[model samples]
Target chain A: MTPDERGEDSAIDVPDALAALLGADTVWTEPPDIADELVARIEQEARLQGDDQPRPAAAGRPRPWRRWAMAGAAAAAVIVGIALVVNSADDDDREPAGVEFAIVGTELAPDASGTGVVQVRPAGFAIIIEIQGLDPAVPGTFYQGWVRSDDGDLVAVGTFHAREDNGPIALWSGVDLDDYPTLTVTTQQIGAGTGSSGEQVLVARFDGS
Target chain B: MTARDEMAARFAAADPDAIRDLYVQYSGPVTTVAASILRDPQLAQDAVQQTFLNAWRGAHSFDPSRDIAPWLYAIARRAAIDIHRAEQRRRTEGGHDLDVAVTPLAFDRTWEAWEVRRALGELPDDEREIVRLAHFEGRTHSEIAALTGIALGTVKSRSHRAHKRLAHALRHLVDTENVS
Candidate 1:
């Protein structure tokens, strides 16, 4: 369903919503005033991670072009071809019950947004994402989406070439939403390396309700 | 340099006192942000602690000239997401269905509330009490005066002061909050 279809008015006004949050019913964790335990916990975690101060640059750190709305793994290699299945919704049978998520744009395509539905199949997970506000891919470039597992492994679910011009784009994944909780759409060139371009246009995480 | 920037400086240098002070100052709202996403109180608390730890690990990259909220927020959000994903994996391994995911509206709405909560935490204890009575308790100035034994005029004045401070602190949210 489109944003218009969703009828976005269920949310309360900001002030009223915020006021409710401050009410006694809302649970806001109050930190222990004493810092010893916090300090100890942090120190122990540091020791486990080698307590390296000024830590080395992270592979998943914010990209030079822009920071992701959330931290994520950089594209190691672009996975394309055979595994990607393009389908017209009219043809394939879909599971009655599927997990859904509100897709969000990363900085690379800040204006873009969408929703993703994942259906677990006997073969794998069949996914469909309806995207809005993104431009169509130009010649030689196509949009590819991936599902990243909790262990940082990436599977290329499917690919497409247009955004709002097309209806919902369907993709398939060999992994379930459990292990692969993140879905990322990145535009890639035909000749681009097998690794993901890392130029993420849209991303969504299906961690929990 | 401003005290905040000074704290950032010490924080970037791994000053223990500065680290502890920053945690004390911001942990409440950080936890609120985590809970807004994770929705589990215990996991939210763990996320807050992990956020601080992650901040310590990445402190060297922090720019002292800038505000620390965004940097700290990103880390807090990342920690919550990591935990959420792990929880999902754990659930699936034990046999369960996917829980309801957070909507973007909820995310936006809660961040504003979280920021306001953080600003509330920044207020002086006396002023914060007045805000709590006025907003949280739904008490009028006169009612607050009677309840807290502070004079009516004093309660009203303190309420005004606290609101002014909050408004000044949360100016960044003005445009975002005004949007429906």
Candidate 2:
């Protein structure tokens, strides 16, 4: 019988027509790593937010003028000794100037916050991130630092877990920061391989402003 | 609360697992919507990521009483369009091939395609299978009945039911398309 002859209440076969038009392959296939990478990035940001707490500044006790003079003399001697060693060493090994960025919470993560500093030396590169009030990483997940270039390419700088004892985690970035002025921290799953999770918990954009 | 409402609540709370669950459910269709526009798997994948990220960020804006699929599909479509524009600009500046042509009509088609697929997924197994065999496998109703060993009348009835439900579910999209 024709489809309409079946009855007014008969089920219409939409899938038949839809399947014919769209096909099975119309469903997009995701690479195995996409979800893991995305989740990791999200977790990284969450951990950073959970860890973002204000740390009190260190206050040194004032000393008497006589004691201060002796302390200054001792500091001067130490500085001279360090200068002499630096002058004796090869000029090619000198440390590059450090750059710092203030990382603030995005509107989605108002309580998530951190501070980032990039220290570049001729021999090596290091980024120190001080995070406060970030949630501890969920099981099997850890936080990763990402460097995004102006052209929109993202590179993983390093990964770390939040620890109760550590105030700030320092990571070595193999690449120079001049080309990658944007630093982002993301939470990533353990086996997500290499890629920014795109879950930027905290982002520090240095626009030369 | 229903599963969708619960999911919406979890998303509003910034629950990572909720976001993950949403990803597992919708990523495929979202990717399809994106890939159709961007015409690049890598860029489409990036759009999927951005879509979920935007959803997570704007979860508060979602009403739990509403259907979550359409909301996410909207976000995914917008993300794909954004990436498409960016790629277009990049290609234009670099003097590269600018063959990627997308318009509002194309986007509406993609959205309709996604909505149909999503509605099909919600159908009963028997009905879904019959429809798939008839449409996807390009089999006749009699062929589907023979292959499945179901009665011919039952096969036709299930197929008709599935079609009716889909038409009702997608009436809004169809109306919107027409209006636009």
Candidate 3:
């Protein structure tokens, strides 16, 4: 059957609506400098990756089938990693609802901001934090989310890595939030233990409302 | 070899110049895709950078024999979605003025829009102009003929061909997505 017969409007004369949706005139225009800037950034990343590990020898190339097999293996590994995160987030044991807190920038990290949400249920609490506008965590360093109580005790919730593109990094935790009345995100060097790094970038107070 | 074939080879070889060439060719459409999702030009630019960086890192995985445009387009769309999610969180947390009346575009619909725009960009100048007139200008076939001083029959023929090509391209994208 034709698309029209199947009642699919998207298949019929898509160009007209598609053109309007894309804003055909304005969508194609881009700043002239963006290409150069992107190329420079890619080169920097390539150089950094190169510095950390030696390049594979140009000789001793594998056959096409073998190369394809290697690529498939690498792709599979990546898919597995992503699936792990997805599965963990979809765990059936967690509560399906939560209270959200706006995590604004502190004086130190003027540009940093994020949100922390705590889901409470009969089992426990599940906390999810989404952060953005933070600098990329340097090698051997990471950002750790902490919850502080009224009496000044700090509890480490979770750690996350920020990328250069400002893509939000979401960290999940199951720590109870009843005692902790405040949330603080801090930058910590690797192996800094579970203690507070004292370099807080974002803070939000929870009033238990 | 064609320019695209040469680019594919260079990309697989990790040639830095190829990275620049790919960016020049694809950045505009990538930004458009991002901007459509995020509704912010600056955030869209960030998505563009992320898209190309991802292309550069994954260049070795690309099949040189296949068309690079669709692959790059897919990455751009994903980057835009990432930005969209991030921006939504920001707006929700910042308590920005979000219009409740307007229905937000679904993720699949946004991807389709991006794909259509990318396909439209691949058309020849005359075909693109005809399609743009029909869609963007809301002109009928005869109106397009009168506006461009082309014959009515010729305008109708070109429009039919452009629509067919667009549908075929979009169908191919759907097939690819289903396979993967």
Candidate 4:
């Protein structure tokens, strides 16, 4: 039935409706916190199961491109760490779903606000910065991303601006692993302006392998 | 709490404060869904935590007008199911747990709900999201049009088509299953 057919009732039994989308055994999982003790038990079992194993990277390191929102000082590193562990084990439990893609290290780019994930494949790393909250640069001004070396030289990765014509821009391309250990993006006021807007957004960096 | 209240009080800007509260609020429902599928409590908590972390990064993608529960639950369900199914595959591929073949059905009144969920998953992402908001969330056609920022007519027709495809895909299951 369409939305019109169902009317405006807010009482739809969504869990039941989505049970099929999730398969039959999914809904009974509703209610209760799954118990803290149970979680601890599972963690212990998981640890025991993988006790002898070494993880691919250190825990809680944010992927590139997910750091834009962190300009405000949010420590998303731990969040990223939890994610890697889960993604590593996802295929073992659920049916495959959602759009799948591959990045060769050049496809990653900053969003319209010049923020996004840097795809670094050789090092087995990728990270994204939150960009939904940044104020867009005005006309005659644009955000440019650069790869900075320890010697203070800067290499241009790309440049972008916030515009209504383009939806939220994201750097989806992958890039070379060595060119950019320190990645930064700055807002260049092309027209006559004072000092830096101090709005250069440092999106994300790669984990050195 | 009201949906607006939850959004404002728990997730104003996706900081740790909002993330932590959001975790506490939905952790119960998330845990329940995960545990039901994995049949393991520890696995369920990990799944719930994963779901919240996902919501944290992707909360910007959420439409504020829609109910947060279903959206969060859906993500959690997928995580839990993924973990459970992956475990199943490992056990079987390595030659274990051969006794279980299919998931047990969870309800009686309508297999239609289950069928709809399955068909929605098969639809392209755009169409699937529209059907989910319209049918599963009980949003009015206008409400869906506004929340998704899509045309109202598109929402109407897509939902209908989604239901039609659901019935077709589930006809066999309906016939054999003990659906009321």
Judge the docking of candidate 1 as incorrect, acceptable, medium or high: incorrect
In order of TM-score, best first, we have 2, 1, 3, 4
TM-score of model 1's chain A? 0.53
- Lowest lDDT 10-residue stretch of candidate 1 chain B: B100-109
Question: What DockQ score does model 2 reach against the true complex?
Answer: 0.12
| Model with the higher DockQ, candidate 1 or 4 | 1
Ranking by lDDT: 1, 2, 3, 4
> In DockQ terms, which candidate is top?
3
lDDT of 1 at B10: 89
Tens digits of per-residue lDDT, candidate 2, A1-209, equal 33333343334433333433434445423423456556655654554444333222224642222122223323423422221111111222342223445676656456877766544332234567787767655434667777778898877766665634447776555555556767777877654667666676777763333
Model 4 C-alpha lDDT per residue in residues B1-180, reported as the tens digit of each score: 675466644453444455555654555456555655555544555566557656755666776566675677678767766766665775688787644333433323223333344344457777666655654465677888899887977876776665556556655655555333
Q: What is the TM-score of chain B alone in each candidate?
A: 0.84, 0.76, 0.72, 0.51
Candidate 3 chain A minimal-lDDT segment of 10 residues: A80-89
Best TM-score among the predictions, by candidate number: 2
Question: What clash count does candidate 3 reach?
Answer: 0
lDDT of 3 by residue, B91-127 (tens): 6787896532221444465556556666777888788
Displacement of the residue A74 alpha carbon in candidate 4, Å: 30
- DockQ of candidates 1 onward, in order? 0.13, 0.12, 0.17, 0.11
lDDT of 2 by residue, B1-180 (tens): 977678877877888778887887677678778767776655666677779878877877987778888889999899889878877876799899887755523676777667766776678978877766755566677777889999988987887787777678777765554413
Q: Which segments of candidate 2 are over 4 A away from where they belong?
A: A1-33, A54-209, B63-67, B101-105, B142-157, B173-180
Candidate 3 regions with alpha-carbon error over 4 angstroms: A1-33, A48-209, B61-70, B97-104, B149-154, B171-180
CAPRI tier for the interface of model 3: incorrect
